[model samples]
Target: MKDFQPQNEEVKAIRVLLHGPVGAGKSSFINSVNSVLQMRMTNEALASSTTSDQSFTIKYQTYKIKKEGKENIYPFVFNDVMGLEEKTGVKEEDIKLALKGHVKDGYKFNPVSSLSDGDHGYNSSPSISDRVHVLVCIYDANASEMKEPVLQKMKKIREAASELEKLYYPS
Candidate 1:
């Protein structure tokens, strides 16, 4: 949302994390949203041009919409993560770490390992602004069906988010 103000002073903007299968248009969606906000076609986040199964995005990146006027940036921000593949893409553990705001921006996705507390990219004490306010799982309608392993990975990520919700909004 443009020019939106949060009721809580601690929150500067809402962070949204977008994740999905490889070539599922995660980056494309970000570009589209930015294009609409800037009123021009621009591809700040590079979308996959190749047909390979590997993910085009390999690092965590945050995208902010900047307007020309006084209200420079929108109150909503987006974080694009590496696409998930059945077996060789982003690991579920890394995604879980990201949801909890442990993974920092520009941190390269290892795929083989998750970010530990001691890692430089790991944020041990993430503030409200650093935490992900929304988790968006993009599903490709063009696909025949979601693979079993990828679906399972997404399920685990969803569970992690749910558990994080408990920590943030405990009853």
Candidate 2:
């Protein structure tokens, strides 16, 4: 995997990461946002893995939401990844991949077996010129508790985002 680095400090990309545990309202939230905004969806959600599974979002998808009564278009990309399980071991790679671009035509991704050990799918780095935006972490309202693991995951995500921001915008 390439070292985590930023390429530019001028271009800002409106990148929003939607993460949550399994059965969270991530997919539904994306759909609802799309519907309410009446934005033209430029891309569809992809399977997170090659294997046929109910929960895996195979591909990272992008959607374009036009501003309300404006000529400008806002591009929103939402990636639905596999949930955080004890043995899946694909967190880091999945996170990096989500930050990367979507799957190419006929290109296949390697399934991750270790959380931190996997290929960084895209070479794209964060850019300050690209408006790197928000990360919305969804949660199941019915979950039993926000235990240790859950809290840890949230912390890591925030840390990663902060680091990225620093890299992209050194102010």
Candidate 3:
């Protein structure tokens, strides 16, 4: 396995996707992270708005973080994708578009579009790696019956990423 290191001083931004099951409080978590960091989301590029039943539909939210003393702005992109098990209205394409940026009908999402080559149509670009740095996979800590579903989803995510790495960069 490759030893992972923190980004260099020149590398200013980081892409993160907050994926998990429904009602696992992904959106709430995002709000809390911003609250702690003293930042607010300004540019909402994805489906952040939804009704009560299917509110968490968007794959993710791209946020621009401006750290103190940093010359370049850090892109704190967080993808709040649908639950893996019960995907009601969510589409795989939406997931692809959220992380790597997408381009459709003259509209351009550079990040999503860059990730269109992977098995799940994600970015395979080295410069802009489309893998989740920190996948905040949430599960109901209290629920008993439904706990397994959430856990299974998290396992699938890990397995998928691991399998992908093994396929592309096998030892």
Candidate 4:
């Protein structure tokens, strides 16, 4: 992978966005990727296997995976969003804005509210580096089916992502 270089030098890293239902192992996936890249078991990102229905992640976070004993950062960045819930969860509008690079990192996501134009965390314009280059929708294999609301939200998100010409991967 080290030999692989981005076609656009203006963008330092390829941003990957991960979206899925609550407790769908998004955080665990990030941790596992980081651990594998570093050749060690690491838990830099918080992950839980609890059965609680409440969402554990609350903010938009970008994680950088670095190889052990190296000062250079990886060419890829993984962005994690608040998990989606049946009744209340990450707003669909917010996800759309995020795909367009309007949502900034560290923005606290409110389940009851969507981001507004005047919000302090909102970025009117973001560079290509800040935009998501790839969108990944994670589904639990153990689950028989997804809730209607959650599925609708995912569909909308996929449409928005497609409009932005971002690579979409369902896993």
Candidate 5:
């Protein structure tokens, strides 16, 4: 993989977006990827189960994987979003904006408020290198059933990713 590199010098890291229901292990997934890349166990991304209804992750965080003993980081980044809830979760509008590369990293999300152009974290014009190239939807297989609203939101997000010509992978 080290030998394989993007042909274009202008191309930066490939951004992969992780999104799913609360407690779906999105953060854990990122940590695992990092661990594998670094060849050791890591807890760089906070991941914990919560009894409360709110999401454990409240901001848009990006995780970079650096190979062991390598000075350069991998040509990829995993972007984790707030876990989705049945009623109170990341706004679909905000997700769409993110898919289109309008949202920036480290942006805090308000469960009750959707992001807009006026937001300080908003990026009016993001280059292709800043856009998400892949979207991964995580789900808990043991869950009895998926909520209708949440399912609908996932579908909308998939559609939005499609509109942005991004890849959508279900996990």
Candidate 6:
């Protein structure tokens, strides 16, 4: 598993976007995947061990896995974003923008507002390399069942992700 590369020549690597409700372990998952790939414990992606109501991550960050003892990186990468909350956290429109590759890395998220075409964080013409190859929603297995509003919001995200995927990979 250490020596991994994408079969498609057009794709340099797969970018998996990770998002979920606040405190769902999205960042931790990125670190975990990184650790597995490096064969060592790594906490490069900061995460709050304690539970909290708000998101610990505020900016959009992409994580690349390095192949141990090799100069090249793995054929897959992980993208971590601010978590979703019912009334706060990352805005839905922001996720949509990210799915379409409009959101650039290091852009701080505004729970109240989404990025527009003119925003510095917005990429008007995102290339295929900037787009997400996969959408991963991390769920907290030990948490209680989600409320209706949050569930509805997640459902909407799923639908939007599907639409974006179709836009990228037409069948």
Structural similarity to truth (TM-score) of each candidate: 0.95, 0.61, 0.56, 0.91, 0.90, 0.93
- Whose lDDT is higher: candidate 2's or candidate 5's? 5
lDDT of 5 by residue, 1-171 (tens): 665566656668888899988888899999988887677899988888564457888888888887655647888888989888987878888888887788888999888889888789899998877788889999878876888888999999998887667343443
Candidate 3 residues lying further than 4 Å off, grouped into runs, are 1-5, 8-12, 39-53, 72-76, 84-127, 147-153, 167-171
Task: Pick out the ten consecutive residues of candidate 4 with the lowest summed lDDT.
Answer: 162-171
The clash numbers for all candidates, in the given order, read: 0, 17, 10, 0, 0, 0
- Model 2 off-target regions past 4 Å? 1-13, 39-54, 66-73, 100-120, 124-132
Stretch of 10 with least lDDT, candidate 3: 103-112
Candidate with maximal lDDT: 1
Angstrom error at residue 149, model 2? 3.1
Angstrom error of the Cα, residue 148, model 5: value is 0.4
Task: Assess each prediction's global lDDT (C-alpha) against the native.
Answer: 0.89, 0.49, 0.47, 0.84, 0.83, 0.86
Window of ten residues with lowest summed lDDT in model 2: 1-10
* Model 1 root-mean-square deviation: 1.2
Q: Quote the positional error of residue 19 for candidate 2 in Å.
A: 0.8
TM-score rank, highest first?
1, 6, 4, 5, 2, 3
Model 6 lDDT tens row, 55-165: 999999988877755557888888899988889999988988888889999999998888999999999998776888788889999999886777887888889989876
Ranking by lDDT: 1, 6, 4, 5, 2, 3
* Candidate 4 structure quality by residue, lDDT tens digits, 1-171: 555567899888998899999888888899988888788898877877684577788888999987444547788988888888888879988888888788989999988889988899899878988888989987778976898999999999998888677343453
Tens-digit lDDT string for candidate 1 (1-171)? 564777778888888999999999999999999999889998999998875689999999999888777878888889999989887889999988888788999999988877899998999998889888899999889788899999999999999999999999899
Off by over 4 Å in 5: 50-52, 69-71, 166-171
Could you tell me how far off, in angstroms, the CA of residue 90 lies in candidate 5 after the best superposition? Answer: 0.7
Give candidate 2's whole-model lDDT.
0.49
